[model samples]
Target chain A: MAYRSTPLRIDRDHALRERILECALSRVADGGFAALTMQALAEDVGIATGSLYRHFRSKGELAADVFASASQREVDALGAALRGPGDPAQRLAAGVHQFAARAWHSRRLAFALIAEPVDPEVDEQRLLYREAYAELFSELLEEGRKAGVFQLHSPSLIAACLVGAIAEALVGPLSPPARAAREAGYPAPALDDVSQGLVLFCLRAVGVKELV
Target chain B: MAYRSTPLRIDRDHALRERILECALSRVADGGFAALTMQALAEDVGIATGSLYRHFRSKGELAADVFASASQREVDALGAALRGPGDPAQRLAAGVHQFAARAWHSRRLAFALIAEPVDPEVDEQRLLYREAYAELFSELLEEGRKAGVFQLHSPSLIAACLVGAIAEALVGPLSPPARAAREAGYPAPALDDVSQGLVLFCLRAVGVKELV
Candidate 1:
């Protein structure tokens, strides 16, 4: 019989792969993608540099996977918040606030995912994830429109605007220079200020007459 | 006096500097920042590569100046539109439409100015220009708020939202891959569709009661 992989070995392999991804993510979170390197990741994962090649074909592929995994978590979280129990307007507000808060808490990771300039591989993943975020919003927008809670045309386009507004509003505060400025006695706006403004702007854009 | 400069010499020098800037802008517009190089720019301007160094201290400085000059023109044009004769709401709508139309027409240049990833020098100019754009919007927003037209709390925050929305919306359509898709058989959205949607989105975000 051909050599067969045991379940124990398969499980170990899967766990090791996940551990590597976790280490990669933490590196990206601590610094931007610029800090992620194959050798560094291998060392972090406590594996041989040659072993990394077995898990990922290239650095770009690894970076793209890290970006997708992080962004996917965000998209899922936002989706749940938007689709949570409430009126359509309340749900949208909740979703916007949740997204802003999450980004605020993890400013470096958020900036890396949302606005950092990166290699073409990561950049392509960025575009795809941006679309994914927009798609989540579009579904909620459509639901709200059908419920007569939102009076906007083109859910897809409106969703894009919402994504754009959220990213742009947060990028300034999340930037390194902005953080440096805050460290230098420039008071940064509180999270509530940004969240409230973003929610109002997004709700109004969707033609929600009375914000909850 | 030690070798006083003539009026004709000064005029010629000014024109040559302008010419170099023009060539630099075209290079960026054609292929984003990656297409720009001192040697290529000198060839385009019919000057020796050494002459280019005399005109510009470094590539970064040259790129920054090109970015600033191009962005300043956009700011001036947008300022005139927003500050033109009309009520705040009407002027805001006109300004949004004008900006969208201008971006849609020359998408390459628009993408370069709005979203192209570039070196730090150009990126710094990008941030400053973005703030310049937001400042213009903030001024209009203040006027609208004072006139009891806009019901927003923070004009600066709202202005950032507007700029972000505008850039994100246009960047997708202006991206190289999007252009490739359009060339390959995809049907691009009409200019009116994007412009109308964008204008409505901005007006609503600013809490304009009756959209034009």
Candidate 2:
């Protein structure tokens, strides 16, 4: 019973940190990263701004922590798509489709984080974030190559392109218009068709034939 | 004589605007956009801050004007690439390679512009900027398609991905160590190789069996 007290105290600290992060997210979502300030976050969390330093050493550290958390959620989504039952082509398409849908929905937050460097300190986490997406595409390409379902010169290079391209799909010319069109009396498709076409283009670049 | 006087005055005004922009670029190159202020720019250009407003309505206006001018250099670059003689494949590679190099070299200013939306009035220019890049890419792809060099669902979509990927390539990851690895002795290939691969991937995506 006494040993249980240690875990409970740790949980309390965790809970408080989570509360601050949640408030930060709401602010960041409403306004871009330009609005995220430690003072504002602390006020929202009902703590002295000094209390924030105990959890995060600096504003960059706090932003990094929050970004890491957001990135992990992104990684988890890719993992689900990767783990879901399907063939290499099917899995890849489904994975990209699901990601595009979700990312397009979170465009404001994603654009703020991806377009600008938050903290140069969290760069590794960003790579981890990229690596997670890379792995999903890599495994699909590798599996397809092994099974003779795909022909590729370099699985790794192609995987990198897919990861980069698919992520780009959620932001650029297509995304902004897609968003506007979605809101302006157009029915939202279950998947982003243009994004799907881009993914298929990569698959075909690897010589995957007969893939829709 | 009176008609000539108005034209000369307009030309002088244009020249002054150009001088201010040139000074702004030099200052931004030395520091970064975040450090650029109306006051500092006024001093740097030998004009009083109040006089500066005669050329640019506000700091936001100045930045937008500066960006509009800098972005024109890219447009000129695009025109130069188009005017030179090459097949669709060669032109496509040349265009992307130059874009990558330009992006890598002017990364500081480019990062500032691409990573943030300007004040609302200027923000509309961002869409037009992206469209220009898209149109440039579309021109190459269309040339390729016309010559039976490229085939795809949409040449426009592929071009956006290529341009977007190139921009994303210039940005550092959220992790500082990885960026250090890139600068230090990492085995990663130079960005030139990535640029080459990107163009090659695009050709392959469009059903080109071999690059010309």
Candidate 3:
């Protein structure tokens, strides 16, 4: 794969770029997007404002960079969570659980960036993640179908809906209290049940026997 | 129907309150949320700032009120759109088309609210909209299930997916160029195809034959 074959060539000043993003994320976390100013970020990182500009093009660029890093971090984490020794169902379950955990942690930062100038780019990154996620599920469905363990009309579309359901269940255009409710030690039947039910529904929809 | 049978008396002041909301929607349409300010809104409605606060406790309250009105408007529209639908599948198609049109028209405001304060009370309006949308699809799915026009292991979950997919497809979340492309008249094959495939796959899943 091109991704696997791509050679690693880290820039020497990548540490500074990473530091800038960390400062911005911290600022955004502290007081939403209101706190993420160029001067404030540069001051926090102990660098001159002009020096900071050398690393990033503009405020919009900086916001875009921070979002890309955060998005890539999330996608990598989701990818790792889905890659396991278990059957397709187990892998999907692991992915959803891992996603909810991370989403709960970064809900504010994630939502903040959605209103930033970089939202369109973030959306593009999201499509890539969705495509990759769909591929993962489709393969599992194909495996199940071959083994007479799964049956569905279109493995790809089923995969899309399964992935879409889980994604939207957490990050619906509107707020889903499920994430915050679960984290606050509140009993959220809707959130917990939906996660469990989503996996079961996907299996059943694909013509698998009752999920275990 | 309670809605049709019950004619609640409209208070003059309450009617003015609604007038404020109606104008605010037009304002949000003309410019973005950035354009809707207390001063501008008051001026637009020929009211004093003090009078505005009388109806709304604060700016957030005003936003919530506006959101509630807009959300209800969408719900009523969805309900009306699906009422005369041909069959389950046809009704589903009509519902998805209606949803896409509404979401596209209100993209900016929807994006703003989605990323707004995670206030439960504030978001309740949107939650109502979500439920209203889901319910419409649920009815269509049930109609399809009964008429042997659709297949689904669980109509409820399928309905959720259908609504979620339409929303996602409109926003496509990460593809601004795609959104721009759509505006520039890149035909909505992805949109139409996805909705069609989902409904068909759903029907096949439950052992029903697809109807034109």
Candidate 4:
């Protein structure tokens, strides 16, 4: 006899999948992609190794999904800020500031998402998310250009430059050496200083006439 | 008995050391630092493994030295362009154009030096070389600021932004996927377009009143 699906079983399955993803994200956050192993993930989720395969086809697939989920959150946050209520210049400034603050607060996860060396699966996801970010900026840039708020030819290329600048500036400070220095009494750059500078630079790069 | 040093032997040793470094660099350029093993290097250089050790203390030291040497060349090239005969803005524009052109011509070596992940020893050198690049830009920015050719605070920070922008823009086109796309009949951005856009963005970011 064929068994019919039950709502309770469906709910249980969904909850288990969420729990597994949460565990995987935490593992990556704490120890980078290197820390993620199928065996370790199964143990963390209190499941047999064989059962874990039912959820994820392979480690690369699992890592890529985790990367995409994390990156999507960042893209969403940036989108909200950039599309929020304000003039184009002000919105851009606010977006930059928010992005910097979020990355600063979670340096490890930020580094992992932004610049960590990972397997090809995750790297492919990274390339896609980078384009996602540029696409968001591109939309705003097009609007600003139409409104005469920005002067530029290639919105997408300029967007990539802004993303690159933000990543580079933050990566240095968020790197292990810089963290160690701060731990050993070397003062880190204040959040305000970096955010303000980043916003100003990005605005100018996009050819915003009036300073925000 | 302490043997007197002979000039011929010294020259031969120097040449061998150079050969080892050259081989190591080529290996890195071809397959990144992961491909750079002492045994592989010795084989490429046509030397015994024991002889290779006599020249360098360890693989890490050898790798670090190769990284430094390669990076120093880039730093020197950038310095010359920025410090060449021109106004502050012109020199900066010229420097950026030259840098982009050079990196475009040698994508593999550029990728190896700029973004390749490696062991801690090489990473440390990467940080130092990045600072070296920043120092050169800082000097030029200071000159520009004093001459009223540009308006920006924190030359070093701004310098970091420029470096990041250039690296990001080029890395995308230089990436394996982008190359594959080009091979598959996709057109790459013309060098003139990229160089011009990059120069314009950089100039504006520095607050140049009259863009080049």
Residue-level lDDT of model 3, residues A94-186, one tens digit each, is 776666566556666654533222323343444555666677777777776786766655566667666666554454421335446767887
Q: Which of the CAPRI classes, incorrect, acceptable, medium or high, describes model 4?
A: acceptable
Q: C-alpha displacement of B147 in model 2, angstroms?
A: 5.7
**What local distance difference test score does each model get?**
0.87, 0.69, 0.61, 0.85
Output the worst ten-in-a-row residue range by lDDT, candidate 2 chain B: B170-179
CA error at residue A40 for candidate 2, angstroms = 9.6
Candidate 1 lDDT, tens digit per residue, B1-212?
Answer: 68777999889889999999999999987887778989899999999999989779999889889989988989999999999999998988888899889888788888877766555567567767888988999999999999999999989888888988887787778888888999999998778998899999998889887778
Q: What share of the true interface contacts does each candidate keep?
A: 0.55, 0.23, 0.15, 0.48
Which candidate leads in TM-score? 1
TM-scores of the candidates are 0.82, 0.68, 0.56, 0.79
lDDT string for model 1 (A27-123, tens) is 9999988889999999999999999998899988888899999999999999899889998899999999999999999989998887775655776
Model 4 TM-score (2 dp): 0.79
How far is B103's C-alpha from truth in model 2 (Å)?
Answer: 4.1
- The order by descending lDDT is 1, 4, 2, 3
lDDT of 1 at B127: 69
Candidate achieving higher DockQ, 2 or 4: 4
Model 2 steric clash pairs = A122-B174, A122-B175, A123-B174, A123-B175, A124-B175
For model 4, residues A53-78, the per-residue Cα lDDT tens digits are 88889988888888898889999999
Which one wins on lDDT? 1
Candidate DockQ values, in order, are 0.40, 0.19, 0.13, 0.33
Instruction: State candidate 2's TM-score.
Output: 0.68
Candidate achieving higher TM-score, 2 or 3: 2
